[model samples]
Target: MTLLLIAATVAVCLMMLMAWLPEFRAEGALLRRWSKGGGENRCSETVQNVVDGFIGNFSAAHNLSETETARIREMKTRPGMMPVTLLLHPQLVTREKGRFGRGRNLTAVFVATGVSALIMPPLAGMTMHTMSLWLLPFLNTSVFFAGLQLLRCAYSDLGLLNMLVTGKPD
Candidate 1:
């Protein structure tokens, strides 16, 4: 049973690491593009679709006027590498004066996971046993990877905002 728990922890760590790699890769490309100089909209159609969807959602959520939402679609970074709406429409980045901020997603995830770590063992009916000990390692590993992923997402979101504001990804 202990060995099984160990294996599960290793497997989850590997899986989570794999899941994060693509985000980092894409982020690197975004950064390189911004560092060089923003240019024509290089983002894929899928990304454009995602931005459009966000515009729709943001308009609905904020009860934006049709003219206001239309302006969001026309907004683009100075380099024109991607749509500025990608940053402005997201609640995580939106701020007063038409700017962006890190917002609370990353911090909230960290705090929630920390609280859950303290709360889960007791809820699982585990006491001070060898299994419980193994559980701690697994839980720690899970929290570490989960936090890492959330951090990566926040980093990417902020990277986009930086690119929009400074017209540079770096």
Candidate 2:
């Protein structure tokens, strides 16, 4: 059972890391473009292609209108606007109202995941006094990855809130 838990935790962490690689690559490309003096076409073709693909996927997922999609595509070309465009995406995407709106749902997830990640270790330590030492390390590693995930979500949420309030991405 302990080995199974460790394997599952490692698998999940690997999957999460894989999911974030594209965003990191895009950000790196953007930074490199900016450092080169922010020309209209400073970004490499690879970066442009990646951004276009991301925009297309986002538009299709959200079922955005033709004009809205065009606006976002235009936003991609402007220097420093790509981050702002992405930060404002949750507002652009439509979803049916549930028990909570999108922002609240994100807040709830942030709070729940945070509490679980923080509380798990100590509680487990106290309850599972006989737990193997190897299992404890795996548990801690999972919590650490969960914390990283929480930070990523928090950054996105904060960026969205900043854009909504100040009309700028931080």
lDDT of 1: 0.50
Off by over 4 Å in 1: 1-51, 58-91, 113-129, 165-170
Clashing pairs in 1: none
Rate residue 143 of model 1 by lDDT: 58
TM-score of 1: 0.41
TM-score of each: 0.41, 0.48
Q: What count of clashes does model 1 give?
A: 0
| Candidate 1 lDDT tens digits, 1-170 | 54554454455545444434433555434533442455655566755565566557756754556766665556534335334323332444444454445555445545545654554454344425445454645565475657655555556655655554445555
Evaluate all candidate structures by whole-model CA lDDT and list the values in order.
0.50, 0.49
Residue 156, candidate 2: alpha-carbon lDDT: 53
Write one digit per residue (lDDT tens) for candidate 2, span 1-170. 54554554454445444433444665544544543455565567876666666667756765655765665666555644454333323432233421112454345434444544654465466446665544544554564565466446545544543343334555
- Model 2 bad stretches (over 4 Å): 1-41, 78-112, 123-131, 134-170
